[model samples]
Target: MLNYLGLPIAASEHAGEIDHMISLVHWLMLLMFVGWGLFFIYVLFRFRKGANPRADYVGAKGKLSKGTEIAIVVAEVVLLVGYAIPAWARRVQQFPAESEATVVRVIAEQFAWNIHYPGADGRFGRTDINRVSSENPIGLDRTDPDAKDDLTTINQLTLPVDRPVLVHLSSKDVIHSFGLFEMRVKQDAVPGLDMPVWFIPNRIGDYEIACSQLCGLGHYRMRGFINVKSEADYRAFLAEEAKFLTQ
Candidate 1:
């Protein structure tokens, strides 16, 4: 059903659940559309001018109409309370521990994404606005002890499959939306605010990170990539980035 609906492949842990809700919503809409269309046809045929010359002021009334209305309301309530709220709560309130998850910071700017990874020490380096430049987009204070092994990349985010990935998202300029369609994750990256988004990638593949918001003239070009690899390959990627730190 999801494929028929033109949805992308579900790659994350919660992507299936998200797609299920979407399917349910669409099913409900289809039911309503068919039911209403039949009702309209019935009304037109049952009350034609030729059949009933006299005008009837009081509209038709029946248990079927009332029952249908109640059923529709109940379906909507079930979707909201049973599926939407719980799914939303799990995404927002329940977060895996940092020690058990792969954590990274994604800073959004005009036409680019800066991905920062805490190196061997597992501690993020200090950043300052004054130190920001073309060479250092995230303003990493390498003089700080924790900053010594920090690694930064432009438009590239790599993570290990089958583990929770926690991304601390922020915007440098205008608001941008971090959209991973395959993972069914979309969050607004607002300036001066740190938004945390987490998901577990179960598929080992490459996915595109799109800026869903119309942020600026270059918004169309503000795209990134997420590479989900095995645990060993993921560590190797970090090691390769670390080697560049010394250079």
Candidate 2:
């Protein structure tokens, strides 16, 4: 169903539900389009100038018309209250514990995504705005003990398949949207807000991370990559990054 709609593959645990909701929305839209088209044709013929030379002052007082309008409103409300709100609540309220999930920080800047990993210590270091530079975009205080082992990557996110990923999302400058189409995840990275987005990747593959919002002049080229690997390979990636940090 997702492929038919030109959507990316469903790769996350909640992707199926998200796809189902999308399909339902499309079905409703199709029904509405057809229904309205038929109504329009009926109106054109039923109120032709040849049939009724005089115009009626009171328009559309029929029960059928009122009933159809009510039905459409009810359908929209059901989608919002039943599916959308529950899905949103589950994502925001039922986050996996930080100890159990793969925790990372995703900071969005003008045209880049700064991926930050807590490394072996599993603790994020202090970041000062004054310490920010072209060389060190995230402003990690390397002198701090926790910052020593932290790893930072540019526009690259690697995760192990079948594990819940907890991302502390923020923005350095303007608002940016962190979007992983395959995961059915899109969250805003606001400048002053630290938002949490969690998803469990069930597939091991490469995907794209797009900035869905029109953020800046360079927004067209603001993109990132997501590499979902096996558990063993994921560990090896961490080891390689750790070694690079030492140098």
Candidate 3:
């Protein structure tokens, strides 16, 4: 699982459920493959010319094939409606009310990612492209009172363990993919639109964040870290970030 190319399912919030579904599908496929393999081999050995030279193609178009086809279709429908649809719906469901979820925004540029926090007010500042500058690359609307209190952080992202987190993603230039392999979260960050992705971090560790989309020359350098810390450490980190932003 760790060596797989895609995101790891070990530490995901829905790891248990997702892994169960994945394993079920895998085992079903394995059984089908082995069963068909052995059946073909048995037929080959039993129907050899020396064994049964009289070729028998009787009942080749019998109701057995039709029943098999119907069974396959029914199985596919059941899996699609029962497993696939439900899994996807569960993935997109908003965080529960009992969980005090954290909201963070990620703005992707040509080669880097800019993270924004709403500060203590829980409201993001309006942004304008006309006011974009080197220091204020996100073009945050500082004239607004809400904008004044909003805190912006570049390259670094921190989350609290066992807390749900909703990340709003966007892009300033081309398309970029936001992915945290360890948490099994991946989404496309597109310009001119905001995409919302939510997840809960169950593990306390440093995870790698990378842009899975190939936008331009510096795409390879688009990388960062996700630190899932204890609640106390997360609060401390937030306090430190707030101070820096205010200053």
CA RMSD for every model? 1.5, 1.5, 3.5
The local distance difference test score of model 3 is 0.81
> Model 2: how large is the Cα RMSD against the reference?
1.5
Per-residue alpha-carbon lDDT of model 3 for 122-227, expressed as tens digits?
8888989998888998999988888877877777888889988888899999999998877767889999999888888898888878999999999999998888
Residue 42 lDDT (model 1): 93
| Model 1, runs deviating above 4 Å | 1-4
Ranking by TM-score: 1, 2, 3
Residue 245: error of model 3 in Å?
A: 2.9
Cα error of candidate 1 at position 121, Å: 0.7
lDDT of candidate 2 over 15-46, digit per residue (tens)? 98898899889999999999889989998999
TM-score of each: 0.96, 0.95, 0.81
Residue range 1-247, candidate 1, lDDT tens digits: 2354799878899998999999999999999999999989998999999999998998658898789889999999999999999999999999999999999999999989999998889999999999999999999999999999999999999999999999999999989999999889999999999999999999999999999999999999999999999999999999998898888
Candidate 1: Cα lDDT at 50 = 95
- Of the candidates numbered 1 and 3, which has the greater lDDT value? 1
**Model 3: per-residue Cα lDDT at residue 3:** 31
